[model samples]
Target: MHVVITGANRGIGRALAQGYAQAGEDVTGTARSGDDGPRLDVTDPESCAAFARGLGDRAVDLLVCNAGVYPDKGQNLDTGYPPEMWAEAFATNVTGVFLTVQALLPHLARATAPKIAIISSQMASDSRAPGGSYIYRASKAAALNLGRNLAVDLGPRGIAVGIYHPGWVRTDMGGDAADIGAAEAAKGLMSEFTALSLASTGAFRTWDGQDHPF
Candidate 1:
């Protein structure tokens, strides 16, 4: 399958790309800075359009909207998360996902059964709102909502959209003391991605395939 993964320069994105490639699947891993090439600034509409243009008519069987930002990671409700932080977080974590999917609709249509995996976070769940990291939480919640709606719209076209929390992975964002390594998270997520289908579309799931409470 031809899989397109965004923010693949590092962390879970890079691991997923490497794993998929080793398994003999066609993978296109992209980064924002175009580091070592294939630049895709998901925050910019024209950039997404340009990326799609570069792809031409190539089929994208699985589009992993993995690019995101936790701009207010260390900020607080009081004088920490500024308006710009909220804007940056939402732009990359929420709007960027929409733009990438919008730009890739044509390529996805070419596939027999296309799928979109949105990498959300467990913190997005309303049931587990302990507060703190408000910006990241809100943005992820928006992304979760976006994925659900996309699933509804795309299911008719044989496209499945699954929102996922990749676990507390050890990455630059996840921190060095996180639960698991990026490779481990990638493995579980790959398994989850493989099992996703029209029947399970619009589901909020964990990296290990457990249904996540919305």
Candidate 2:
């Protein structure tokens, strides 16, 4: 199987890439700096288009939209979450996911059972609102919504889209106090991706296979 993962230079993305590589599957891991493989700036339409065009006719069985930003992690409610920050977060977290999917649709169509796994967050849940990190939460929520709608639209084409909350992983973004390691999250996510189908498309789920509250 051929898989394409974004933001694969570090964290959960890197782990996922490694896991798939270890399994002997063809993997293309992209980063903005091109340090890992190709330079894919998900936030830029031109960049996404170029990346897709560079792939030629390669069929991508799995596309993981794992590129995101959490700029408002510890921002103060009163003075933080500046307008620019919100823009940056949404551009990367929400718009970026859409652009990647849009550019890769044709390649995905070439696959037998193409699947899209969007790495959202539990914080995207409206029911789990505890305030703080407004930008991150809102952006992730948008991503989740996008994944759900994409699942509906792409189901007829044999492309299943699953939105996932890849546990609180111990990465630079998740911090050292996070509950799980990147490898654990990657393993669970791979299983979740493998289990995705038209019947289960649009489902908001955790990395561990549990249904997440929307």
Candidate 3:
């Protein structure tokens, strides 16, 4: 399968890219900078369009919207997180995913049983614990809404949409002290991806294939 994964320069995205490429699947991985180079900037629509246009007539079988931002790196939401941070988070985690998917929808339509997967987080769930990273949590919640909306809109067109939380994966984003490694998360996600179907569209699931509460 020909697949496209964003934020492939490091962490879980890099692991996912390697997993697919090593499996002999034709894969296009993007990042801000890297070996194959960055082909996607989540904040830019023109870049996404250009990349989609460059893919020729073959539709991408799977488009994994794994790009995200977290303020936990240097900024904490506790001691006065700027509203601008919320906007930035939504820009990449929410709006960016929407634009990327919208731009690539046509190419996705050309594929047989195409799927669009958004890399979301358990923090998105209101039912789950929500005490930190307000911006990240809110943006992911919005992303999940977008995914559900897309399921409703794209289902008729034969595209399967899903939202996934990769667990506390060990990555730059997840931190080095995280329990699950990026490779493990990628491996688990790949298994779940293969098991997806129309029936599973709009569902929020964990990397191990368990359904997560919306």
Best by TM-score: 2
Task: Encode model 3's per-residue lDDT on 102-207: one tens digit a residue.
Answer: 8889889888999999999999998987486777888899999999999999999999999999989878788878889999999999988888778889999999
Please rank every candidate by TM-score, starting with the best: 2, 1, 3
For candidate 1, the C-alpha RMSD (Å) to the true structure equals 0.7
By summed lDDT, the worst window of 10 consecutive residues in model 1 runs over 70-79
- Winner on lDDT (1 vs 2): 2
**Cα lDDT computed for each candidate against the true fold:** 0.95, 0.97, 0.87
lDDT of 2 at 111: 97
Clashing pairs in 2: none
Looking at model 2, residue 100 earns an lDDT score of 100
TM-score of each: 0.98, 0.99, 0.94
* Best lDDT among the predictions, by candidate number: 2
Clashing pairs in 1: none
Candidate 1 global lDDT: 0.95
Q: Compared with the true structure, what per-residue lDDT tens digits does model 2 show for residues 50-96?
A: 99999999999999999999999889987777899999999999999
Lowest-lDDT window of 10 residues in candidate 3? 71-80
Q: What would the per-residue lDDT of candidate 1 be over residues 68-127, giving only the tens digit for each residue?
A: 888777675677989888899999999999999999999999999899999999999999
Model 2: lDDT equals 0.97
